[model samples]
Target: MGVFTAADEERQRGVRRMKTIATGALALMATVFVLAKWAQSAGAGSWTGYVAAAAEAGMVGALADWFAVTALFRHPMGLPIPHTAIIPTKKDQLGRSLGDFVGENFLSGEVVRSRLSAVGIGSRLGAWLAEPDHAERVTAELATALRGALAVLRDSDVQAVVGEAITRRADAQEIAPGLGTMLEKVVADGGHRRIVDLVCVRAAEWLEVHSDSVMDAVTGGAPGWTPRFVDRKVGERVYRELLRFVTEMRDMPDHPARGAVDRFLSDFAHDLQTGQETRERVERLKREVLGRGEVQDLIASAWNAVRTMIVAAAEDERSELRVRARAALLSLGARMAADGRLQGKVDGWVEGAAVYVVTTYRDEITSLITETVAGWDAEHTSKKIEAHIGRDLQFIRINGTVVGSLAGLAIYTVARFFGV
Candidate 1:
C-alpha cells in the first residue's frame, strides 16, 4: 500500500465507492441469474429465460467496463494482459499528446489576443494605476530598478562610453553653423546685454583696484625723448581719458562704444555662419578643444559626478530628487483619476502599445508555449495531469454501466414481445 495522506485517503474512498457500485451491479446480475435458475427448476414460464439472458448480458457489460476502468490505474486481478496499466505504460505518449494539444489549442495567438481584448487590459490598468498608492508603488519600483542598474554599471565602462559618444557626436556634426545661429539670435534679442553689463561692472572694479598698474602702463608706454614732466602730464591726460571713457560706457546704455560692441558681435556671427575662413578657424578651435587631456578628464569627471549624485539620491529617501519624484507621481495619479480626457489619452496609448507588442512578437510569444511543452519530462507531466483530472473520468464508467443496463432490459422486453 502507498503512503496515505488525507488527499490519498480521499482518493482511495472514491475508488472504493466506484468499486462498491460495480460489485453491487455484479451481485445484482448474479442474484437475477440465481432467481431465473430457481424459477426454471420450479416450472416457471419462458419469461424467466429471457430475464436470465438479459441479466447475464448486463453482468458481462458491467464487468467489461469495470475491467477497462481498472486497467488504466493498475493490472486487473494481477493479470499481465496486453494494454493493461495503460496510464503507467503509455504515460509518456499521453503527456506528449497533452502538451501538443495545449500548445495548439490554448496558446495560439488568436486565443491570447482575444482573451486580452475581452479582459479590457488598458482600462483596467489605467483604473488601477490611477490610484495614488498604486502610482507611488510603481514610482518606488522604478527608482529601485534604476538604482540597481546604476549600481551594476562599472564607472570606467560608463566613462569610456560617455567619452566615445561625445567624440563621435563632435566628429559627426559641424558645430559652427549652429553656434553662429544661436549667437545671432542672442544678439538680436539683446540676451547678451546682461553678460556685457556684468563684464563692464567687473572691469570698473578691477580698474579701481589696479590704479597703480594702469598708471605704470601709461608711464612705460610714454615716449623716451619727451621731458619727464611733460611725459607725466601726457600720461595723466591719457589715464583721465581712459577713466572717463570707461565711466561713460558703463553709465550710458546707448553709448557709441556699446553700438560698436554689438556691431562687432553681429559681424562675427555673420562671418561664423557664412565665411569659409571663419568656419575653418572654428573647426580648428573645436579640434584643439577636443584634443586636450583636460577636456577628456572633464568628460570622465562629469560621468563620475552624475553617477555618484544619482546613486546618492536614490539611496536617500529624504533626498529632494526622490521626494519631488514621488510628489510628481502622486499628482499625476490624482490628475488621471479626475480627468476623463487624460485617462482616455492614457488608455489609447496603452492600447496602442499592447497591440504593437502582440502584432510584432505574437509568434515568439506563442512559441514559448510550444517550446516549454516540448521540454517537459513526459511521464511526470502525464502523472501530474492524471492527478488533476482522473476523478472526473470515473464518472464515464458509472454512466456506461447505468446506460448499458437500461439498454439490456429494453432488448429483453422487445425480444419477449417478439417471442424470441
Candidate 2:
C-alpha cells in the first residue's frame, strides 16, 4: 500500500474486478461443457455436442491466457515453472536495454540539436526577455549571482592569484623599448620642456636660499695653502656662476643651458632604444622596482579594492554598474527579438552548446537510468509494473475466451457440413 500510488490502488481494484469476470467466464464455460456433455450422452441433440466443443475450447483458451499473464509477474499457482516471473528475473537486462535505447536515440548530438532547434529556444527567450518585467527579473538574478560568487571567493586566495598574475606578466615583458618609445614621443612633442623649466626654477630657488651653504662647500674643497679670503672669494664666484646659470635656464626658453638639457634628454632616449648598456640598466631598475615588498603589497591590494567595488555595485540597485547592465540587457533583448539574423546566431550557439553537453555527458545520463533501475528490488519492481498495466492485460484474457468459443463453433460447423 505504501509503495502504490492512489491511482495505482484504483487500477489495482479495476484489475481485480476484471480478473474476477475472467475467472467467472472460465467457470461458466466449464459448467456449460459439463451440462452439454451430459446431455449429449443422454442423446439429447447434435447441438449439445457443438456446445460442449465450444465450451471446452473456451476453457482451454482462458487457462492458457491466465498462465501467460501471470507468468510475466510471478509463478502461476506458486509453482516454480521455468520462464515464469519473467519481469522480476530479467529486470536488469530490460533496464540496460532501455538505457541503451535512450542513449542511442534521444541523447545523440544530432537528435538533441534537431529538437532544440525546432523548439526555437533563442527566439522564445528573446521574446520573453524583451518584456520589461522579465528583463528586470533577469537583471536581479544576475546581480544575486554576482554577489554570491564574490561572497564565496576567499579574499586571500584572490589576492594571491592577482598578485601572481601581475608579477608574471610584468616579468615576461621587457619595459625598456616601450619606455624609450614613449620618451621619444614626449621629447618630439616638446612635452619635456615644461618638466625642464620646472626643475630649473626649483634649482634656482634652492640655490638662492642656500647660497651660504654653496659658498661653504666650494671653500671647503679649496687648497689649504690659499688665503682664507681668496678661498672665500673663489667660493663666492663659483656660487654666483651656478645661481646665474640656473636663473637664465629658468627664464630664457632659448638659453644654451636649456638647449644642453634638451640634447641630454634626446641622447638618453636614443640610448634607451638602441644602446645595450642602457637597456640592461633599465631592465635592472625594472626588476628592482617590481621586486620591492611595497609594490607587491600595492598589487595585492588592487584586488581588494576591485572586489569591494564590484560587491558594492551588485548590492546597490541604483549603482551605475547594475543600472547599465539592466539597460544593456533590455536593449539586447529588444534587438534580438526584432532581428532575425541575431536570432539565428543565438539559436545556433544555443543548439551547439546543448549538443555538446548531451554528447559529452550521454554516458553519465544513461548510467543514471540504468543504475536507478538496478537498485530497485526485483519483486517490488514486478508488482509496481503490474499495478500499472495489469488491468489492461485482463482484457487479453477476456478476448481469448470469447475468440476461442467462436473458433470452436466454426470448426464444429465445418465438420458437420463435411459429414465428418
The TM-scores of all predictions, comma-separated, are 0.65, 0.73
How accurate locally is residue 58 in candidate 1, as Cα lDDT from 0 to 100? 69
lDDT by residue for model 2 over 1-420, one digit each (tens)? 137788888888888999999999999999999999999999999999899989988988899999999999999999999999999998888889989999999999999888988988767888888888888888889999998999999988887788778778878988788888888889889999999988998999999999999999988999999999999999999999999989988899999977887788888888888999999999889888978999878977887799899989988989999889888888888888888999999999998898898899999999988898888899889888888899889888888888888888888889999999
Candidate 1 lDDT over 208-293, as tens digits, reads 78777787787888788878888677777777777778878888899898999899999989988998999999998998898899
Native-vs-model 1 lDDT?
0.74
Best by lDDT: 2
Ten consecutive residues with minimal summed lDDT in candidate 2?
A: 1-10
Cα lDDT of model 2 overall?
0.89
TM match of model 2 to true structure = 0.73
- Per-model lDDT: 0.74, 0.89
Give residue 116's error in model 2 in angstroms: 2.2
Most TM-score-accurate candidate: 2
